[model samples]
Target: MGDGPVTRETTKSAADDIRVDQWAGGVRRITITRPTLRNAYRSQTAVEIAAAIEQFTADDADQVLVITGAGGAFCAGGDLTSSYESTHADAVQLGHGVVIREGMHRVMRALALCDKPVIAMISGPAVAGGLALALACDLRIGDDTARLGDTSGMVGLLPDEGGAWLFPRAMGTDHALRMLWGCELYDAQQALELGLLTQVVPAAELESAVLALATRITRTAPLTTRVVKRMVRNAMSQSLHASLIEAEYAVAAINDTADVREGIAAFLDKRTPRFVGR
Candidate 1:
């Protein structure tokens, strides 16, 4: 989006939760805004976020997605009041699982399925479902002002919003259960130590640092970035032998991309490479 369209879809309340901004170098940032609720999402908010992610999935013009929130908080979790609202005419006839499966669960799936990179910019509390949202991202950049953990159990709830699986995978079952059961909230430093955050910075530098990283990613070969992301995710559940075989084929295909040729040419010419996502 360095020299492309710039758009801002801003609206108050859950009617429109998505505020999409185009930064330089094909970086598309989506800011979730629900200031009255500490950015806590309802059914409509999750739907909008999921829709934005699905749009990003196909839009080649966008190379990266930065997900953050307006105000101080990243997200507080799902809005409990609306979590079980069946009075709405559009409400599903099915039970509780369907509500979540269609709401935040869809948002989780969208983030997981997105080919482009998703980075979380955590400013304040990111607990319960909010933690799941952050963990779903490819990377999370936080500041000392932030708090991270699972507090769903305190309210007699569970990590139904992707945390059930994402938490364990990120910090192992023991740590995940400890946090979930204990309803613990950790500071930014503790979150970093627990592998919940990629990096932490001063509150003043949080935005700049995350944007800088996103920009750096945009400068890399797009094909390489996508392929590497896929390969690594696949390797997590695959055997070493299977992973190696996949890498063999992946390298062969990557070497043939036009971006690879451009990279080689740039190296030979002693110049910065310009990748076109070919």
Candidate 2:
């Protein structure tokens, strides 16, 4: 969570490369603004995105996060052919993987630590590190024009930004390896079949669909949502017995919250429950 100053601004800010905005239904949206190169992010762009994610993680009022790109495209990944050396010259010395460690790695770390749910709103191409970024999120909603793939080998760079670990898990090891080796790109429907996307809508309806999804999530119990995100992600690697034990612990902590009482009372009364994040 971010320890820096965080405020709930009523308006959206787009002065920087990454636009951060807090919307109704307690949703925070982060948009990469470099749409010319299909939103191919540089080091500064990664830093800004990481900061936005951390801020969302820290803010109490924000219930869900929506990450997307401006224009028609999603992120095209990091610019491998750019002047990365000049950008990193001021920060750290050149060494084994120092560039990514200081740049996009911060984003991966932030995403991993975030207890809140993240939704990747993918529109156009989301390849390479961009694909990894989307995979890190709890859910991915894409449009029909959406594209996903790995082009790391073509540029002689590995998916150093969490793709190496996330790709194999999203779509089995064999399929992930096949796509990686072939530098394959898939359309939204194909990505959905491969388990990369949760849902795919038409380009025109993408915004409304994503907004509806976020609003639906915001109506859920906030504390339960965060805990469920963590527990489910951890359960992927945990045994059934261990997961049960973890669930017991979670229940123990959550049963005492005022929201639980509100939920039970609302159920008996046949009314909507008002949760205050207690």
Q: Candidate 1, after superposition: displacement of residue 231 in Å?
A: 0.4
lDDT of each: 0.86, 0.86
Q: For model 2, how does the per-residue alpha-carbon lDDT over 1-278 read when each residue is reduced to its tens digit?
A: 12222334443455577877765558888988888889988878888889888988998888989899999888999875563633465442454266687678999999999999899999999999899999999899999999999987886767788999999999999999999999999999999999999999888888778877887888888999999998998899999999999999999999999999999999999999999998
Q: What lDDT would candidate 1 get against the real structure?
A: 0.86
Let me know the TM-score candidate 1 reaches against the reference structure.
0.92
135-184: candidate 1 lDDT, tens digit per residue: 99999999999999988887787788989999999888999999998999
Model 2: lDDT of residue 261:
93
Off by over 4 Å in 2: 1-15, 81-96
How close is every model to the real structure, measured as TM-score?
0.92, 0.91
Q: What is the C-alpha RMSD of each candidate to the true structure, in Å?
A: 3.4, 5.0
User: For candidate 1, which ten residues in a row score worst on lDDT?
Assistant: 1-10
Candidate 1 deviant stretches above 4 angstroms: 1-14, 85-94
Count backbone clashes in candidate 2: 0
